[model samples]
Target chain A: MGNAFKEESTELAKKTAPADLMIVAKGLTKKYDDFTAVDGIDFQVKRGESFGLLGPNGAGKSTTMKMIGATSLRTGGELTILGKDPNKQGPEIRAHLGVVPQTDNHDNDLKAWENLYIYGRYFGLGRKFLKKKVEELLDFAQLQDKRDVKVDQLSGGMKRRLTIARGLVNEPEILMLDEPTTGLDPQARHILWDRLFRLKEEGVTLVITTHYMDEAEQLCDRLIVMDKGKIMAEGAPADLIKKYSSKEVLEVRFGSSKNAEAAEKLKHLGDRIETLPDRILFYAEDGEKVLKQIHKLGFEPATSLVRRSSLEDVFLRLTGRTLVE
Target chain B: MSLINASIDSAIAIAERRSGKFGAEFYAGRTNAILERAFLAFKTSSWMIVLSGFVEPVFYLLSFGFGLGALIGGVTDGAGNSVSYAAYIAPALLATSAMNGAIYDSTWNVFFKMHFGKLYQTMLATSLGTLDVALGEIGWALLRGLAYAMGFMVIMAPLGLIPSWWGILAIPGAVLVAFGFASIGMGITSYLKNFQQMNWVNFFMLPMFLFSGTFYPLSIYPDWLRMIIEALPLWQAIQLERDLTLGTVGWSTLAHVAYFAVMIVGGLYFTTKRLSALFLR
Candidate 1:
């Protein structure tokens, strides 16, 4: 009977086999008591792809990452990782996946190197392998100088870098990072991006969740923009911007007093105008032409500039709210 | 038949490699990994914290041995033989010390690792499962209990409190008692919502320490009250230590072992069940 069942599963695997698909989820949902965190959503991630889940704080990006990380069980969905069902084979699937959670969960009392060493031990790696790996990881994280420092004593960015380095102790097939640079300074963010970019160049599959649109654009090969537990759009950053927003955005600011009134006067100047408290944005294929046309309409802005569109513009257009919370 | 055997052998090999199938060595290796982490942490901590376990019980030994022993000359044993008050309370103190050491290690240490340290979260991210975590933590608690029990035994032997060479057997007995309490204590610690609710730990522990035949014989209490005390698992630990130190091995020893065996099983069940609920959900 077991052999027959195994044969049936192998048949199913052959049928559903994607192009080196690393993760696949369909109708994925997570409900907590009466509240649903991740509503039914569908997506696939190919091998070696850097995939991003972009959303605000409660938009279920983290929830989806947890499912793909094989840590949290999905409430309702068909989710598979490396061709193993996440529900039945969590430990098996997790063997090849490395997860850096949103919060750094380092063993605070241990030294940075010790943290990496112990985490490697959990994968049942040999001591001889770990010694060389720890040195390499410390150098990779640029934490060689701080290897002896206790984890809690490191700066926020150093802690994050160490956490990322610790995740690589297993030399995993895929690395999942949730908000990898959320609390970092600009310099720290750039350093981490460099580190992550290097990891990608090594052909490690990445699954990242981020509210920072630029981080999404910088790290993700393709992304899904989520709002209220549902995916609003999914595409490459540039493709998403082109599909949802225009080529450029014209930002025109009036005095705070006339900002609301200025938006009304500027309504017909572009394809769409979104008015904020202090500025009005004109979404148009040619932002310079829109600015010129606004001047012809006897509407002079205190200051104005034309800039190319971004993923942020696309998110704002779809969600009717800002991405960062 | 050879073809079938070859296919079956290949299938088992695939299953073992793919599943990271845990044998005895797998569990021992992973749990030792966790203890190795503890060892790393201990290297950085002050020696005072490590010594504090031995110090507290020794203080109780001196204060009670001299103060209360002077006040009450001697007391009757469980089998109705008169023994010095110092000797009477010494064996029971080992039990209570074991309880205290295991309780603190399992509850406070485990909770801190769970919520504050996020250590278990990081461990779970690896190939380790809920059972690995439970056993690993219990294993650490046993190490701590062993150290404290051995330290107390060192003090007890020098004071002429041991009535028999069989009293030497109490070292392992104290560790067994510690294992029971540590497992059960970890089970309760898993349910705690926050640190402030830790008063409940003290609440459960203080009464058990006092009433579990630790300070006095159960015969002094009414039969109904004695029955209730007997139901508590700590009382069995005290009985085991008391019998072992006095060299009075009897059939009831198995009953004491059974009490703790039930606790070990039950506590491990709850520890894994509750932790899986908290973490894997």
Candidate 2:
């Protein structure tokens, strides 16, 4: 824990001095009638960086994204995008920002090409300019063959891609996506990720909010873990894994009811332990050593395995709940 | 006075400043784009549905003004005198048609786009403000109203309904009437939480249609009831059409114009305010 903390703080110190920043939030808070949705959280996003907000469903990630998108006003605190106050300069700032909301809100009544053209028109683009731009966007979204197709006829993945294409109509500098692959199949998720990867390569700054740990691990350069509207930790995925979780975890099942009993005895064998309905987990530097210890203690399990730690383990350690449960 | 002025100021600020750099031309184009979007998306079958709307009021005009005209004789006018049955009810049918076309587009269509289609949210994500949406949608409603008004006029001559050259103004007059109904209808829809709440629209519309002097004279109702019904925008619509088709132009025409002007401005103002509260929160 000490060495991991040292590594994370040093990494944070380096990132704090980023040369160019596209977004900055200071003590940002959002309050509703009964409770706080975002509790004075702080973060910074540098230019051309792939940043993430990782948390459970009600972690205020969407609320924070709304504030940064300049659509929802901040109840308190300050937010700046492209070096302008979002509250006072929402339109000016949003002119350079692209937002893919949690759901695809594309114009379902229009054809694919018409959706792109009309969305670009909202930015006051000329018909001649949009004629060329729409073709380019249709090609970019891989919908050139489906240009005249109505939006309701497209598959879920195609709808998402068209929506992303519409977001890029203005050639925005910062692209913010909320749960970009929430409902997609595995293959479609990969294709969308590839598209996002290409956008990052093109020097577009990306701000993403997702609950998928592998998504955070694969895409984000830096992320802040949030729970109950507050920051739990902040670092790169690997750094967060090293800081909040052990190097490995051992899983053993002693059926259902006895798993808790086994956990009572197995608690002393590892650095930390977590128990579930069907399995017991031992967090340790060496998973093999923990398994051996469990065997030596004369505990027979239904099944046992040893694996390396992942962001899931870190999430569990920090929030005490699985990411997808 | 200041409140209306302030809302107008903020609304204009959203239109001119928040919409972008191209100024008035850009604003016009964006609003037109929404109408254009609908145009591009409409299928032949949908056009059939729009054409069918024109047929309904004609049926009413035929049933009430032509078929029942002999039995009903002349209707009592505001001045307590009998007027031609066909002429008296022609203006009423015109007013109801405008009301139906405008309210249908603004309420059911707007609700569908807002809740199910998720269309406005997407547009609002861009530089489009509440004003662009308001004007664009109401503009489309007015276009429909214009078509109906013209068709109503062409048919009015055959029915022995046209009485004066001032009847030409009813073309623009239909637009004004639609603007008032459509704007207020959209304002009410923005506050709605679900489809069930839409029944209130029917509740208000049914009474306004029946009692706004669209059919019988206001003399059937008591004095207090007439006063209440007279203040409604549809009543003003009916009265304006009656005066124009009768060639009874007078100074009070300006007062009728002012009533609808207030309705148009006030309805549009509340629409923008309510939309901002709904989408920009």
Candidate 3:
């Protein structure tokens, strides 16, 4: 714990002094009636960092993001965007921060391109500049094919992309996305992630919230795992896995529920044992060695597999719960 | 001077100076955007606009002018001036339609944009302040009210309800009435949480439309009730439009116009403050 504090403060100091610290939140908090949605927390994101908030449902990630976006007022603490207080300078702060909300609330009355055009105009952009910016953003979000269509007529993915494009109309310095790929298919999710990566490479700061551990692993330079309005753990994906879990995980499934109970009796052979409804997960440095020992115990499980431990394992270890729960 | 008084005086000076520039440039920009959107909505939904704004006024004209006017012929106005029932009621319907259209757009449409559509949220995320949004929305309401008034005027031209060429100026007068109501409605909308509360606007607007000299002149009312009705904003607007359209202009006409002017300025001040607190805070 002492070492962790030292490292965290050092990181915080480095973040505070960076020339491009676009977003900063200090001891931020939010409460709705009796329930505290976001507990006191502090963090910073540099200009080009792809930061993430990884947690399951009801984890306060959305509340934290909304506060930074200047849409939700903070109950306590200080928050700054581009070195301006959001309380007094909300319009100015928001002018530099692009936000894609959790849900697609595109104007049904406007066409796909008009959504971008009108939003640009609201930012006080001239008509000629907004027209050109709308075209460029449509191409960037890959919504050029659906530019003229009414928002209500477009598919879900198309609408989501157009909303993302609309946020960029002001040419914001920081971009925040809440659950960007929550309901997308595998192909669509990969495409969206690819676009986000391209944005990251262009030196745009990104702050994203998601429950998908693999997504955090793929996209985040650093992330915080939140639970019940508090930060449980924070680190880079690789470092978190190394600190909380073993290098490999072994999965053993018995032929019947009765057999699975028998296999659990031999859990002392692994570093950590987790019993699921049908399978038993064994965390160990050498999954193959642990599997051989289990085989020698005459368990003869129905199925067996071995794979490297992932951020899912780290999340489960830190929160004492699975991500899917 | 004390610091507090000094700050207050400086604030007032800034407001006075900025009001002139912001009022014209900002409202012009906002009014332009709102007019564009209203036109686009009308272009796509022309039938709805025609049915609501045009047909509804005509229906009111037929029902109250010929049907109800027969029972209440040659009513005396507040100034004890006798006029034909149709002439008295025509301007009232004109004012009522303007108020109804403006209030409907400012409250229902603005509420939807604020809550469900999240349109204002998106707009505020840009450089547009809360004042810009309020001005834009009220400007749109005024434009819609202007269109309805113009259409009503054309219909009245052939009916001989229009008494003189000066009646042409009543269209813009009706728009000022709409702007006052629309600005007040925007302020009321910022306080509302759901669609259920909006019915209260009708509670106020409907009574004002019916008893505020819309059908018969206020002289028909008891003295106390007439005084109260005369103080209502729509009553003032209707009185002005009636005098202008019926060629009965007098010094009281300036007071009627001043009433709407006060409502416009005071309503806009409160509405912008409320909107800024609601959206920007």
Candidate 4:
């Protein structure tokens, strides 16, 4: 029976590229009691691809990531990681996956190197292998100087970096990062992004969940934007922007009281207009032309600027709400 | 196949059946890794925490066994042999030492690791299963029990408290005692919601320690109360260890071992179930 099953799986793998598809989910769902955290959702991730789940808090991005990471069981779905069911083969699947959770959970009593070393041990890695792996990862995280220092003494950014390094100790085939840069300063975020970019260059499959659109655009090869436990859109960053947003955006502010009124008068000036409490945004192929038309309409804004479209606009367009709020 | 290979295969088959009965995601059979992590963490932890478990019973031995035993004089052991109050209470203190070590690690330590440390979350994210976690943690607690047992035996043997060659068996007896308490304590800890709820473990423990014939004989109590005290795990542990050290081994000693064996199995079952429910879901 085992032999027959193995043959059948081999035949199935032959139909695909065998290793090309790293994760596949069809009608994935997660419900906690009466509340559904993730409605039925479907997506596929290819090998070596940097995939993103972009959504605001409680949008089921983390839920979906957990299912893919094999730490959570889906309520209803056909979800597979590396051609194995997560619910049945969670430990086997997790053996090849690195997970960097939202918060840093280091063994604070242990040294930074010991943290990496012990995490490697959890994967059943040999002491000899982890010895070199720990040193290499410490260097990768740029924490060689803090190797012997206790994790509790490390700075916030350093702690985060050590956590990331600890996750990579297994040299996982897929690295799942849940909001990897949530509480970091800009410099720390940039450093982390650079490290992640280097890993991507090394052909490690990256799965990231972030509300930061800039991080999504910079890291993700393709992504799914989620809202209210459902996927709003899925595409490459540029493709998604092009499909759902205009080429450029014109920002005009006429004071908080006048912003809504100004948006009504300037509605015909651009392809679309979204009025916020403090400012009005005009989406048009040519932002400069929209600004000029707004001036011709005899309503001069206190402040005006023209810039290119971004994933933030696409998210706002799909969800009807800003990412941070 | 060779006998060894055949037995090994059957063992694996049994394990597979157990995993299937529970859930396949729950066992990777790599509990040693979890033990390694504990030791690595322990290297830097304050030794005073461990010393406290060993010291509590010794202090109890010095105060109640030496100071109070002076007034109480001799007491009748389980085997109907009249023994000194010091020798009589020493074995019970050893059993309490084992219980203290096991309970400390499985309850308070496990609680901290579960809530604040997020250690289990970190471990679960890896390939390790809930069974690996349950067994590994309980095993560590058992080791603490073993350490305290050995330390107390060293004190007991030299003070001429241990009266028989069978007293050496108490080391392994301590392991069994520790394993039972560790498993049940870990299982019960999973149901606790907060630090305030954790105090309930200690609340039950203090009375059980005092009344389980640790410092005196259970015959002092009425028949119903004596039976109630006998049913408690601490009494079982005290009975087993005292029998081993005092040369009072009997059929009831086997009953005490059986009691803890049941606790070990039940505790493991509940602990694994709770771990998967809390984390995997």
Of models 2 and 4, which has the larger TM-score? 4
lDDT of 3 by residue, A1-325 (tens): 4345435544554655456777778888898889999999888788789999999899999989888877667899867766655554455556567789899888778888888877766555567766777778888888888888889998778777887888776666678999998888888888888878878877778899999989999999999889888888889999999999999999888755665576558869788987766678899999999999987887777788999998888877877788877
Candidate 2 stretches with Cα past 4 Å from truth are A1-19, B1-29, B43-45, B75-83
Error of 1 at A285 (Å): 2.0
Query: Highest TM-score, which number?
Result: 4
Locate the minimum summed-lDDT window of 10 residues in model 4 chain B: B1-10
Off by over 4 Å in 1: A1-12, B1-29
A1-325 in candidate 2: lDDT tens per residue? 4345435534544554344877778899998887999999999899889999999999999999988877787899867765555554455566677789999887777789988888877766667867877888888889999998888899999999998888887777788999999999999899899989988888888999999989999999999999999999999988998998899989899999899988998899999999988898889999999888889999999999998888888888888898777
Candidate number of the best lDDT: 4
Which segments of candidate 3 are over 4 A away from where they belong?
A1-18, A253-264, A276-279, A300-302, B1-42, B67-72, B164-166, B190-200, B247-255, B269-281
> Largest DockQ belongs to which candidate?
1
Return the TM-score for each candidate structure.
0.94, 0.90, 0.86, 0.94
Give each candidate's interface RMSD in Å. Answer: 9.2, 15.3, 15.3, 9.1
DockQ of candidate 3 (2 decimals): 0.21
**Winner on lDDT (3 vs 4):** 4
Per-residue error for A318 in candidate 3, Å, reads 1.2
User: What lDDT does the true structure give each of the candidates?
Assistant: 0.83, 0.81, 0.77, 0.86
Selected candidate, larger TM-score, 1 vs 4: 4
lDDT for position B159 in model 2: 62
